[model samples]
Target chain A: MEKYKRNERIGAIIKVLGDNPSKVITYNYFSELFSAAKSSISEDILVVKKTIETLKMGRIETIAGAAGGVRYIPIMDDMERKDFINSLCNKLRDKNRIISGGYIYYTDIIYSPELVDKIGKIIAGKYIFKEIDYVVTMETKGIPIALMTARYLNRPLIIVRRDSKVTDGAIVSINYMSGTSSKISTMSLSKRSISNGSKVIIVDDFMKGGGTALGIIDLLKEFDTKVEGITVLIASKTPEDKLVKDYDPLMVLQHLDAQKEIVDIVPYEHKDYV
Target chain B: MEKYKRNERIGAIIKVLGDNPSKVITYNYFSELFSAAKSSISEDILVVKKTIETLKMGRIETIAGAAGGVRYIPIMDDMERKDFINSLCNKLRDKNRIISGGYIYYTDIIYSPELVDKIGKIIAGKYIFKEIDYVVTMETKGIPIALMTARYLNRPLIIVRRDSKVTDGAIVSINYMSGTSSKISTMSLSKRSISNGSKVIIVDDFMKGGGTALGIIDLLKEFDTKVEGITVLIASKTPEDKLVKDYDPLMVLQHLDAQKEIVDIVPYEHKDYV
Candidate 1:
């Protein structure tokens, strides 16, 4: 518990603000929650705010009114969103990067901030109409994108890990086939990570067969929550029926020939961003 | 050209610094490059430096000596790294986000400042060993990651679009089977985008079939450059014949069961980060 005390506190404050975004909390509320003084609570709030602002994740709007406390809203607009995505794309195209079997080695790009930002905005823009509450993606690289999107939308990004970790409490698991892997894989989400009636967006970098995507769709149904939409960075006409056929692709992988040495790619139009 | 004249100027300055980390550039050089005044050049550097610093992308080390100018270096430690990722992760986990199909809708996250910081740090961390002159990724989601990583690494995040846009000049393309689409796809990098002998890293969200990964690798090889490494968030067990075999995974999809009544799931180990 101590390992995550700071994180837990931030989560709690976020939750309180998230629950009633319009309703601000006084220092006294956080003070009582952590058994700390009012000043300490204010300091913690500063940390939270600093973290939010530094990450471009969200904003902690403060009101000095007698009844005002704090409100957190995650939002971003077009120019900033495009700039962030442009940054990530640049990293993935570096010349020094290696490639072997036919993938552009972009493990570094997945962890990069620019990619996370663009992914966040793309997903947020897609679901802006849904009045969404939680953002979800399968773990690892999707985590950053999910987190960034949640920050932009002023919501939360929940990660469905492939397996339960020691840190996650009371894990809920599911079995789903990965169309790309052509194998059944386990996916897990924390019991407390999501709530009922939550609107979610599913995102990933690439989608081939989409068994994992479909599996994720099925998982949300288990939570009694709604899936607002499905989005992928790249999509193609793979041999298998795509699990994410219903979703839109930001970019399309039209054709590629590893043996003959030919590959065709198409970028998503800018119309969506503008 | 006009659309990105200013951006390209800033990008050029970043590239210059990236190529020569130990050297400084006089305001006169930038002024001449942009056909602006010395004061304007200084102002632009200030803006660029501030932007990079705010994102923690990198630092613009200034020298006051008569011959002194500005230089950049890619540097960050574990705590900064951890804090960056945690903030992004927290933002994406907002409860108000809605979920469906197991994906976290995060188009906005890609554009958010929060993600820019986290992703910048993540990619920079991976290239710590490499004398990276640039960060690269394909278009769309990968752009932001490339940009931010470039900022942190004090380099330019060069982009390789699927196809050439009107603004781009001549391009060299490669063909490889896309892991996601399983078809011949075109992969291209602008002739002006990157320089030879640059160190680079590759990144993406998921490694399913890794066809796109391979296509990118092929494109890089066309330039006869060195790829520092590849990193990904999720490495789905798509089959061992992937284009990228030696790489790091933030998380792995360890288990799945498509036929089960209620699926059972588990997440990958946190050892990668630890």
Candidate 2:
């Protein structure tokens, strides 16, 4: 096989490393693939690493030892992150987004690949250092962001269903009261979705009373799994008494009056990151 | 700003172009961002373009005009795509995946980011040249894959819900028969999800008799939209007659016997691609 040029090798490395975020790739693998020497591969990696860092796209962590290699961790610098969240807040603050029944028409943002990818990276960056076996979310709107987060973290995404379906086989269903409506609702998960003692991070598009998150927590308990963290794109400001206490919300819906077509949103102030 | 090295500029260019697939980006933006001349940026892009093409990762198209720039289109060679599908089929062939009601427990694959991303790329590649306004799918199992497809295609994802929620505002609901059970079911979509005369592509995780896809087609009619294409990860072979006539299915599940745990699966032979 012909040896790949420096530019070719660098592009291939970025594609591989970027595709498998947080997963280490040994230099030997690249050297063999490119028919290049280890030192040359190392030089190529340095260029990729520096460029990534300079652009604030992500970080490349190098492990030194017999079983060592480099891994990509997607991240956004504080300025970019703050800018992204502020822009998201501004978009959410649009008066036209106020639909009937006090809800915002933000499905476009939720499902947009570019926006969801950024949100996933931001949320996944927070828990990069933490040990999370899986990223979990309920059915419908949350799946896109959760899937992207799982992709970045190199973990499986487990979605909790609103109702148990025949396709799920044996499922563990739980009844919980909706924090927003105070109405009882049932959530179910297939028995094979998560293993016992697994650690999971829950993500969702919007949070009102944290009832759905609470329901997920209860469902996870049924599997003997633990909820490591809960994150959402937006959480309402009206519900001060949240069922799930520990959580991370990117933006807070300060106020929304459908009748007046007024909406106020602010980025959540993270004590540590801020 | 210090002028970025060729290698550094190449890496950053790949990230930016790769991140926004199919979206044209002007050289002026890159030239200004890197404090370099337009000619220098063009040289940098050439190298990145050749490298990507050599690796068969994707193609970089440079349109020459006032509205023209560079756009990245992700693709996988026939061998890689076949290998991916074969591996997916092998995983699905596992006897343990057989659930009680002749259903396959493959939610893991549906929610898997890596697999789903690849599937999305393959499906999106098929329709890259086609003008599609939105990538549509039903709620639950299909959202993750559909979301990725929408992301790669750079289009909005429209999800049809099993039932209309109050948050959806005004909705258009339609009843359809389940191919497997022959039971009537209702599917709804927000009125604002798709506009009149929009062209949509329907995607799903599994198809029994194409009933769900047909339902989506019927639902799209309410908005005067058209179903340009329908793609699914897997489709059952038992019911040879399908509700939807034209569709692309990755794999044909020939047989699945829960009692014997016997299964027969094969990749769908595309008339053109094959």
Candidate 3:
């Protein structure tokens, strides 16, 4: 709070919400306490709401009727979450994504949050249903989706390091071939992470050949926990099938031939939420 | 909109906000339009507010009088625009962080949006005063900060790829000696990225030695563009002064001796925004 104004109306609003079991509060009372214009109070609430909710500190509820006001609820549940992962699937399935040879190009989807949120939500919803203990994802592209899902679920996200560090202490490593390279790569997590029998949801941005999916699956097994569910933002349509099965995909890439500049993207069957 | 009923409501809220000159709206009208309960409608509003506003669609406003409601304003001045980057710099300077040897652990900060928002805002603010045409950052840890800053500023974030792929066509590479290792390694990005004279900001998660920062600086200079700003989440207090003088660190590490078991952290002085 050094750079931010401590006595600002927004800070006061957040302070008024200090550790309350109830997430809801009346705007009028908050407005009165701040002694600011209702419009200014409203703006402060808007900023605070965005900051807290995005930071995963419960959610802000704005009631409009006679009893209407604002509420800050510090609750985390498995239901009513879906957006990022689903959109990610839709963008990944875009036929316009031309993959030359065996590799698929996710340039459009990675750069689009609409897609990322869609896929993040779908994967998050599925895991939230299973009482997930933690969210585990690899580095780079997967980090964004993992961060999004963890935020939605209100859980701590732990990254599986590609290279073990001395700071991480003794680590447990898992190696599997990548979907695209067919070359063996490794991922590791701290030995003290997630207790035995804990449920874990594996999420990634995209899974073309399922090599990364299988690698995560391997890591989960090594931890002696439940895989619970595996979610990928996008999967490629392979005539020869993929490396792994029994997982969910947000979207499917039909054709990706970058050479001909043709990419066919199709929507997934996750329209139930609509 | 295929993932949740709330998404439909959120989408409707955005659609209602289409091209509206006013930045504020009444909760009653929005709720009535959806034919949803005022409370439920408020919940929907919060979701849409965070998603859209975070993505830089506009700001949310509230009126306090009996006739007041929420409003969406699409105005962000240079200072206000960089809130994302500026926040990024602030949160990364947490003194609570513990570092062993030269490496600092910011995994917890990266996973938190509140922290990310702060870090994102600070970095964005630095370039807000500059003539930045683009935002650039290295892969892995830096992508999230860069992306958040880019989103808030409504600029595209170009990532430097550590590993080259077939789809990248031609690539330009730069070498840097990592903090963990004194050996030099090459990092590459697509050749057609930043145009000549384009102003850029270089961002990263941690700056143990500034090798990667220097590497990206070299790469941007290769494009004949100027590096408008260099911002990092954490800078190591390695006793040896940094080689790159044209950089700003949100936090500087004072102690990082594994054998000594001590660490200190502090924030950098920044412009006061009231």
**What's the C-alpha lDDT at position B227 in model 2?**
82
lDDT of 2 by residue, B1-274 (tens): 5578887887888888887887898998888778988888899889989988877888899999898789998877778999999999999999999988778889989888888989999888888888999999998899988988998899989999999888788899999988767899999998878889999899999998888888889889999998888899998886889888898899999999888888788899765541
Local accuracy by lDDT, each model: 0.59, 0.88, 0.61
After superposition, which runs of candidate 3 have C-alpha atoms over 4 Å from their true positions?
A1-102, A112-130, A179-182, A192-197, A258-261, A271-274, B1-104, B128-131, B167-169, B179-181, B192-197, B272-274
Query: Which has the greatest TM-score?
Result: 2
Question: What docking grade applies to model 3?
Answer: incorrect
Expressed as tens digits, the lDDT of each residue in B203-262 for candidate 3 is 887776677887888877778878877888777767355657777776766665555545
lDDT of 3 by residue, A65-179 (tens): 8887776544332233334334444544454444445455564355443334334544555554357777888876676677656645556566777777665545799778877
For model 1, the superposed segments whose C-alpha errors exceed 4 Å read A1-130, A180-182, A270-274, B1-36, B43-60, B63-274
Residue B189 in candidate 1, Cα distance off native in Å: 26
State the DockQ, from 0 to 1, for candidate 1: 0.04
Cα deviation of A274, candidate 2, in Å: 10
**lDDT at residue A266 of model 3 (Cα atoms):** 56
State the lDDT of candidate 2 residue by residue for A1-274, as single tens digits. Answer: 4478787788778878887888899999988888889999889999989888887888988888888888989887899999999999999889988887788888889878889999998889888988999999998889888988898898999999989998888999999999878799899999988889999999999899889999999889988898888999999987899888998899999899988889999999876541
